[model samples]
Target: MPLKPGANPYKILHLEKGCTDKEIQKAYRAQCLKWHPDKNLDNKEEAERRFIEAKEAFDFLYDKEKREEYDNREERIRMAQEHHSKRMAEADGKRKKLIEDLEKREKEFSNGGKRSADGSTPMTAAQQAKKKKTDQRNFKEEIEAIRRQLEKEVNEEVKQKATLMKTEREKHQKSQEKLTPRLLLKWKTSEGLDYSEDDIRKLFSTFGIISHISSAIEKKDRRKRILEFESGANAWGAELETGNAPMPEITCEWLQPPVETVKKASDEPVKSTNTGANNLEHMSLDDLEAQIMGGF
Candidate 1:
């Protein structure tokens, strides 16, 4: 679906230049669970918006080519913030040192020193020169302090306005699915144009699009299909307007070497019951894969 309003994750999960592909996916799913609209129905529109945003977030950061672009942009943002902070810190230090210098000079002049070079007591000329220097330094230091404080306030203001502007936008609409992402996929089998739920689940689930237990229900005569979600909550599939499952371009063989040492994530693992984390809202690629592969 086209991203919902207030759905952007520009502020939610941050992706650094060093984030790995795995980390991007993990961060996207985690933030989606927290901000998904279905789970927070009281604010349905906002929730839906966030859901789309999370999807967009996953798309941008997970796609290697696109992720590079996003990482570059994020790095610029961090750099700007860091630069502003550093400037302020330096100004503060300068202001403090100037104040201390002025105080020390005043104490030295008051303590009664030797006479001036011209045979005059060290009072008038030397003290006047010292006082004038101190005054000029104080003026510059105070102005710098004010400028830094203003910059700090400006940065904070910018952040606040950006936040307020986001939440003020309308929530996401599912109708925008016309702009749905094109699923990059190849046939599950070379010989059979059909997909085997077992292997298909293993592969696609590893990627995040869970195939339904119903395999895929299609009324080609009627041009509609109903597919079950891993959540057991049935939704329209094949009907991309609803939410079509996306598959990857590469075959399983091209993915990675086989794993002989896989273990269960028992605590946060997927449970078949409608009562557990396997529900639509919390399902991750791993969770969906296990569900489709018959949890075997």
Candidate 2:
């Protein structure tokens, strides 16, 4: 008759039967922000718990009939509680009457006016020994019960400690493995020289370039560009030491100009025929072309 949960569940959310749909929805959202599955992915138990709470709230609020049923059930539970409380009070009164009767008997015995069936005090040694033995057995049984309970608790505690130590050992081993040395760089034919991925990227960054240095073997075009850039850079560095300008670099694009632009400028030589000769239409790089046309 009495309503009682054997243990506390420590729920993340609680909803009452009388709660409005809007109120329930608001509570669900507020709880999900902190206890959603995605938010607690690392804790499978916690994630499942929150998921279950959210689902329960949704199930109760989504259907009108189900909600009405839940309300009825809660009312029944409240009535049952009230009845149980009344029953407990009645039982307590009866128990008090029984205990009073027992006390009345105990007091009559303690008045020390009892006599044996033979109308004389008799020393029954065998009966007294048997009673003492029975008392000892009962005491021993109580001690054994306590010992078994202590043993069960000790075993459970040991298991918990073992599990925690295992987790800690795994974590420690992972850290040790990560600390071990790594081969950060290795030679690849297309890359030309051995350098770590970070170091190669650093070289690209130094030249104000933000390109990805992909696997040179898998990506041939990236490999060629890297080699060409490195080669040209090395050559220019050499000429700079001798106090002389670097050699002119060549490209396929420079050898061919846009025919339409060249034709447009060449045909419309309206003013400054010489100025039109060195127009951007005939050059790949305006700055380099300007320098060349200036005098050198």
Candidate 3:
């Protein structure tokens, strides 16, 4: 079976949860040495099992992606536990109320001689009291059964929600991983001002090889530019350096594209153009101007 959130990898490795990666590695190595089958010749089978368990724990904790998944699972488990606890408390309160009501009914019956609602005695008071007691017992039993069933359903729902959340998170992570390297460069320029293709190239040349530069469609007034880099690393580097010092007279910062934008970009068919300048030409002047002024 797959390891669930309740199964602590750290426990298997004999380390505390949230331990440093270095600590985990150290513990794993020690366990491997201690449980090596060759060293435990008298109990090779037990030693092998322990060794595999330790190795599996280490593998799950070592990977960044898997570790995140495990953390989410643990969080979901905690939430479910909290929900169960609260529901149980409510059930206990209801049980107490039912007991109180039964006692009150018994007092009323004693005072009123257990008469029927029509004001005529149905049986002797003792017989009527016994019947009431039986009814109360049956009611309590049914309530208990319902509470148990509700608890079971709630637990199942929580588990299902957790599974769904994990699946969606994995899907989102995959989509983010597949996102192309792109950077939005916001710049400010006076009205009617424009930068030539060569000039723009010269300005961003220090950053990285530019894949494409287009006016920001969203910020026409600001003369913002979206510069796509051949690599994300280069874009990140440029963003960092630009923040430290102004890129010439122009001020700019990097903007992360929205998920929708990234998805759209990923889906759009790539077109071949003869020249980099032609890429800008194919776009309307208004659109190009908007892209340029878009960044600040």
Candidate 4:
């Protein structure tokens, strides 16, 4: 039986699209064997219909021109379907994007552009609190580090200053130690009376033990005199007490010894008082015997 126009011959024969002519023939033979009227006497009518459909499919596919036309038509229909599906997919994608955009805007509007509309923060309250605590801890650590650095610097500066002061003090004390307990005195009396060295010495003698007193022999420096004390403390005391002077013109000042004199004094060697008998005590027995033999 002839197939109706637009009927899919490949479907009737259970053949795949783009099947070769040999494959179509093989499919038709197999259908005929399965649905022959003689092979199915009890279901002859249905078998005959199936058999006729298969025969019509074979006839249509056997004609190369008709088969090419059908294939072309099918290809055209398939292309149209694919084009429609592509358009539909594109439209769906656009629709989805528009919906997403609308939802985003709506969500933003609902939350005043800050968060989602569900009144939910991106992080939980506990998480936010923990982050805040971590940040605070880091800030404190930085501050503590800075404070420690500053304190260390300050302590180092103070220590350096103290060390410097100690060194300066030691140097001053050494310099002071080199000075003798002596004071230089000069007087311009208000009464225009000449004060002898003895008189000046007698007046300052009340402060401490006076070692000696001498008047300056220089004619131009006739008012100048030297007063030596037994001790530095006495010399300083006398200087302090006589700072105002008996008549405001008798000034006393500490006398600094010359550096060369002090160095010379320090470099002087001690004289040994060891006699021959005194040396004998320190002499080795061999050396004493050798000395006695050498003298003989």
lDDT of 2 at 138: 60
Give candidate 2 misplaced runs (Cα > 4 Å).
1-12, 105-296
Q: Where does candidate 1 stray beyond 4 Å?
A: 1-47, 112-120, 124-296
| TM of each candidate vs. truth | 0.38, 0.31, 0.44, 0.37
Candidate 3 least-lDDT 10 residues:
270-279
Ranking by TM-score: 3, 1, 4, 2
Clashes of 1: 2
| Candidate 2 TM-score, true structure as reference | 0.31
Indicate the residue-level lDDT of 239 in model 4: 49
Q: Rank order by lDDT, top first?
A: 3, 4, 1, 2
Judge candidate 1 at residue 90 and give its lDDT.
78
The lDDT values for all models are: 0.45, 0.40, 0.59, 0.57
lDDT of 2 by residue, 117-203 (tens): 567764355654565566556655655665576567557656765685566456534433332110011122332533444655553
Candidate 3: clashing residue pairs, number:
17
Highest-lDDT candidate? 3
Worst 10 residues of 1 by lDDT: 252-261
Worst 10 residues of 4 by lDDT: 270-279
Between prediction 2 and prediction 3, which has the larger TM-score?
A: 3
Cα deviation of 74 in candidate 4 (Å)? 0.5
Model 4 ranges off by over 4 Å: 113-296
> What global local distance difference test value does model 4 have?
0.57
Q: Which lDDT tens digits does candidate 4 get at residues 1-296?
A: 22444578989988887789789878888988899888999998798777766766776677665677667756855675576567556655655665565555444444433555476755555655565566556655655665576567557656765685566456535544443455556655455556776777678877667767764433332455666665333233454444334453566654422112121257853221111111132233344344433432
